[model samples]
Target chain A: MARLKIESLRKSFAATTAVDDFSLDVGDGELVCLLGPSGSGKSTILRMIGGFEQPTSGMIRIDGQDVTRLSPERRPTGMVFQSHALWSHMNVFNNIAFGLKLRSLSRGEIQRKVDQALELVGLAGYGHRQTFQLSGGQQQRVALARSLVLEPKILLLDEPFASLDQHLRERLREEVRDIQQRLGITTLFVTHGQDEALAMADRIVVLRNGQCEQVDAPDVLYRNPQTEFVAGFIGQMNFLSANVEGGRFRHPDFTLDVEVQDGPAVLALRPEALRLEPSDSPDAAGVTRATDFGSHIMVDVELRDGARLKVMTAPDARWQKGQTVRLAASAFALYRQNRLLARGGLPVETVEGRSRHALA
Target chain B: MIRSYSSTSGRFDWMGLAFAILLVIVIAVPLLVVFTWAFTEVWRYPSVIPQKFGLRFWDQTLSRADVWEALFISLRLSATVTALSALICLPAAYAFARMKFPGRDLFFLSFLASHAFPKFGLLVAIAAIFLQLNLIATFWGVVLIQLVGTLMLMIWIPVAAFQAVDRRMEEAARDVGAGPLRVFWSITLPQAGPTIFAAVLLTFVSTFYETEGAWLIGAPQIRTMPVLMINFINNQVVVQYGAVLSVILWVPSFIALIFARRVIGTGSFAKGFGA
Candidate 1:
């Protein structure tokens, strides 16, 4: 295992930049996921780290050794592509043994290593089978084995589970994580999947438009997103436009006294943070719709200003169309110019004061 | 959509059966007549079949020194043309398929220019040049002219085959510690081998039957079988000599077709054309 340091990595095509000044330091044996939507340069960064693509500028070091200009064969890195990329001309044994044979290993040792790799992938007896004869999941296992058999210091996975069905993707990801932990291989996974990143990565790097948005643990990213984009991208968030005037954030349906410069702002509220209660006042928000999702009910509420928002609450038969209700956010983030200004609604005084101010 | 008539319930497919019969008769009848003519000592128009069938012309045609020389020349010219064209075109095809260089597409399209015009006119122009260089009636002169015809098949089919190879597989090989050359030999070439072999077989067969270039460039001094067969057909009073030569010319093509059947059965031959 080895630590990977990417410093100021930049890559550009002829006209546009793919990755812009991207930098990250992955600890030894840590699986850091580069998470983003399409065209966010996640794959470009992974390719640079794997030596598939050269960076337009910057340095990549493995274990403090500069390897930015090394070829893929010379680097201590192995990659698993999304297509499984198995050599169709070779059988499973030969595919896994290809790199070993290239290293001029003895025939008996190559055979032993290949057998051991197949067993590790739970396909102990499939050495002689052609890659085309295997199922999609089995083929992916063979791909994983082919990379892992090389015993590289760094493993690069470029959305290896993207093509798999949901059930199989979950199972294979778990298996891969288990193997990675057992071997303690430093892995950098690139994906457009949020749940996969959240479930598999020790630290997830959320990217947007070829720049780093936020890099943190999954729970921290969910609970304390530092930007409006991160708040919206990571989980379900209800963005309510408000005005921050004289240190008091003002919305049509609510207001909160916050420590911030007065300007236009947004109240980014998580669905679970919002609660609803039946109210007799006609000016209170009206429920437009409610969906029963087995464990919780999602109530769509329209405030007095006709802005709609979703509130997640315990299953309640009373949350139906045209039901008047008062809304309350247990915790919410206040943003100004797309940047987080304050996270309020924590203390009892603040939560109660916001409601009192709204009612006034 | 119009549904085709189904033949699944043991019903007779008369249209299909008629088409099959017509295809066989159209293709096989001339071959049968040629074979008959090759063995016939005498045959008159009034007789439905030959009055007597024997190998008289086969022995006669096989006995001539010129005929043996023509046969040997034909084989040598075809082998040389096919090998030389393969050496020149395969790498060009690979570069056209994989690289991103200036004028790559234009250069690739120019290979078609050889076959785009009337072939005889092009051969005449080349033969004029060959005469000035004292290359006329030389074996290499004939090989050069025949090489023109091979450019299309040798480059086009193999380009499609090489383009069909998955780049990700090569990248995966590189990731697994193989260098660029090793990846190409182990991953790229093997995947594209069958279709390339099919292209070679087609090139060989076409070169073997190439007549116009051989007749135009290698007249008088170097005579291929087709050139000799054309001579016999025009001058010889005995019909069997030409017929026997026709059957002899068909031999290599028939063997090539058998190999082509297997190659095409694997589906790579047609796949080389984006099938």
Candidate 2:
């Protein structure tokens, strides 16, 4: 295992900047995920780290040794491409043994190492099968085995599960995490899927438009996003435009006490943070729709001002169209002009499971 | 019940059957004529079949020293040209498929332009150059001329073939610690093997039947089968000998066609094209 340090890396192509002033330090034996949507420079960063693409500026050091100018073959990194990229011309054994042969290892040694790698990926005795003959999931395992057989200092995965079906992707997600932890390899996984990043990484680095937005533990990033983009991107959030006046947040439909300066702001509330209580007050919201998914129900409410909000509640909470409901947020993050201002739990006043708000 | 089912499904369409028979006759008649001429001792006008049939012409043609020498020259020249064309085109094709250097499109378009030019006209100009260099009537001269005519096929097909291979496959090879040369040998070349084989076969057959280039450059001294066949046909007295030689020339092409069919049937060729 090795610690990878990237300092102020940037890549530009002609007129477009793909990755700009990006930097991160991945600890030894830690799997850090670079998470972003398409065109967000996550793949470019991964490619730079793998030595497949040269950075326009900055340095990449592994274990304190500069490897920025090294070619991919010389870099101590192994990458599993999004397509798996198994050699169609070679059978599974030869595909995994290619790197070992490049090192000029003996026949016996290559065979043993390949067998061990195959067993690690749970594909023992599949060595003789042709790569094209394998199923999509099995082809993915062969790709992983091919990279793992090299025993590089770091393993890079570039959206490896993007091509698989949802069911197989979920299963492979757990398998990949298990193998990474068991081997304790320092890994950098690039993916656009939030769930994959959250479930797989020790820490997630969220990127936007070639810049780092936030980097933190998955749960920490989800609960305490540092920017408006992160707050909205990490989960389902209902954004409400409000203003701070007299130490309280004043929205068109409701007003609540907050510790902030008097200025324009936006409040981001997660669906689980909001509670919906049936009420008959004139300020109450109307339930437009509700969907139950066994464990919880997602309720959509439209206030008197015609602004819609999503709230998650217990599955037993029955709601119907045209029903009047009062909205209460347990926690929220307030931002001013895309910068975080304040975030915490709200002290809501309630009476018999209903929010106590005066009707307008 | 089985008879009733056959009667419904196997109802014959007379028009389709007649078209199939006509197509077979159109293809087979010329082949039958060639075979007959190879064995005929006497064939005159308005005779559907030869009055007398024998292998005298075939035996005589096979026994002649000039015939065998011309056959050897044709095979040797074609093999050399195919090898040289492949050597020149493989790397060019790879660069066209993978890299984005300036003037790449212009350079590829030039190759297509050369391919589109009339071969006989180009050969006349090339023959002039060969004469000044004293390359006329030499074996290497014929091979060089054939390479110029056939280079486009060798390059164009393989460019499509190489482009069809996913770039990720090569990247994965590099990621596993294979260098550029190793990656090519283990990954790129093998994936393009079938297409490259087809190209080689195509160049070989075209060079083998190349009458114009060989006639223009190596006719009097370095005699290929096509040149000798042309000479025999120009003289009506030895037309039967030309027929025998033509049958012999068709053998290798027939075998190559069969081999190409098997290679194409393997379905490895054209794996990536238009995918």
What lDDT does model 1 reach? 0.89
What class would a CAPRI assessor give candidate 1's docking?
medium
Looking at model 2, residue A144 earns an lDDT score of: 97
List residue ranges in candidate 1 displaced over 4 A.
A278-293, A297-308, A315-326, A346-360, B1-29, B39-43, B46-54, B264-266
lDDT of 1 at B89: 93
> Across residues A1-360, which tens digit of lDDT does each residue of candidate 2 receive?
799999999999899999999999999999999999899999999999999899999999999999999999999999999999999989999999999998999999999999999999999999999999998999999999999999999999999999999999999999999999999999999999999999999999999999999999999999999999999889889888978998877776656667889999988889898888788776677899999988999999987778889989899989998898877778878899778998878643223333342322
Residue-level lDDT tens digits of model 1 in A159-252: 9999999999999999999999999999999988889988999999999889998999999999999999899999789887978888887775
Once model 2 is optimally superposed onto the true structure by TM-score, how far is the C-alpha of residue B117 displaced, in angstroms?
Answer: 2.5
Residues B195-250, candidate 2, lDDT per residue (tens digit)?
87887898899999989889999979999998998888787585688889889999
lDDT of 1 by residue, B1-275 (tens): 22235558666667777777787789889999998999899999999899999998999999999999998998898889989999999999989999999998799889989988999999999999999999899999998999999999999999998998998998888888889989889999898888888999999888888889989999989999989999999999999999999999999999998977876556787777772
